[model samples]
Target chain A: SQTIHQWPATLVQPVGSPLSLECTVEGTSNPNLYWYRQAAGRGLQLLFYSVGIGQISSEVPQNLSASRPQDRQFILSSKKLLLSDSGFYLCAWSDYQETQYFGPGTRLLVL
Target chain B: QQQVKQSPQSLIVQKGGISIINCAYENTAFDYFPWYQQFPGKGPALLIAIRPDVSEKKEGRFTISFNKSAKQFSLHIMDSQPGDSATYFCAASTGSGGSNYKLTFGKGTLLTVNP
Candidate 1:
């Protein structure tokens, strides 16, 4: 069975700080990876998606960026975080069927 | 622009009652439709899905009804339970395989099944 992992499960940071969130999938190779953010009581917003290593597509212009350093490893980063950047970050993986499976997610709080 | 639109921003239903959520799409190229259920602070999970070729598909207590002519689809939960209380999302996408497909999701509906 395939599983996805993300960390830290919860994060708290001051404004203007750097941000880094990691996502890794096991039991699958060359899977499509995606980054999404959900604000409080809001819908999911696609931030970035990658087809392969070093290939990333930005769905919307925002303060965050994504990188696929490895086949199953994806990272979401920001040089400086804004108050609006705080939200629940989700990592998802999918195969050719277009059915996406999600990770536990990371909750970031900016003060 | 929002390609998929879902109705009922919030719903409250008593236990054992039926729960229904509706979604409509404008894009005719979309061949895949899926519904996701999300608990508080958790990632959304795929609950059920239906292809355009099928008018209705049922699995266990969940069912997906697709109306190709109206460009609409809906999810029905029979005998709704408190455990079914969660946020539901509807998504549609074009293409079938590979990394070429991207899903356009609805704003989401919060469903609360009172016990």
Candidate 2:
């Protein structure tokens, strides 16, 4: 069985502060990882995706960035947080089938 | 452009009643359809999925009915329970290649099951 771990489960950051969220998957290798932001009562907005180490694609232009340091470790970071960054951030991964399994999600609140 | 359009921004259903959510897509290239269920402050979980080749697929109380020509699909929950109350999203993706499974999700429907 595969599991995805993301932390911190919840965070409160002041405006213009640096931010980092980590996601790691177990029981799979070379999986495609994705970062998605969900607005309140809305659907997901794809932020970034990584096919492999050091390879990242920005689906939407914003302040956030993603990196794949290891085969199963993905990180979402921002040099300076924006008020608009407050939302639910989810990390997901898929194998050949692309049936994504999501993490518990990080609830970010930028005050 | 929105690849998928879902109806009923929110729905309220009484327990033991039927719950139906509909989704339509403009891209005919989509070959796979999936429905996800999400609770408050949690991630969306895959509930049921269907292929264009199949008209309908059912798992327990959840069923996905796909209409290829119509470019539409629907999820039906039988004997809905309070536990079924949550947000539902319908998504579509094409699997032409091994990596073409990038999902495009709908706005999502909030289903409220009243006791």
Q: Estimate each model's TM-score.
A: 0.98, 0.98
- For A21-68, candidate 1 gives per-residue lDDT tens digits of 999999998998999999999999999999899999999998889999
lDDT of 1 by residue, B1-115 (tens): 4489999889999999999999999989899999999999899999999999999999998999999999999999999999999999999988564466678899999999999
How accurately is candidate 2 docked according to DockQ? 0.73
Q: Tell me each candidate's RMSD, in Å, in order.
A: 1.0, 1.0
Docking class of 1: medium
Cα-based lDDT at residue A108, candidate 1: 98
Q: Which stretches of candidate 2 lie over 4 Å from their true place?
A: none
lDDT for every model? 0.93, 0.91
* Candidate 2 B-chain TM-score: 0.95
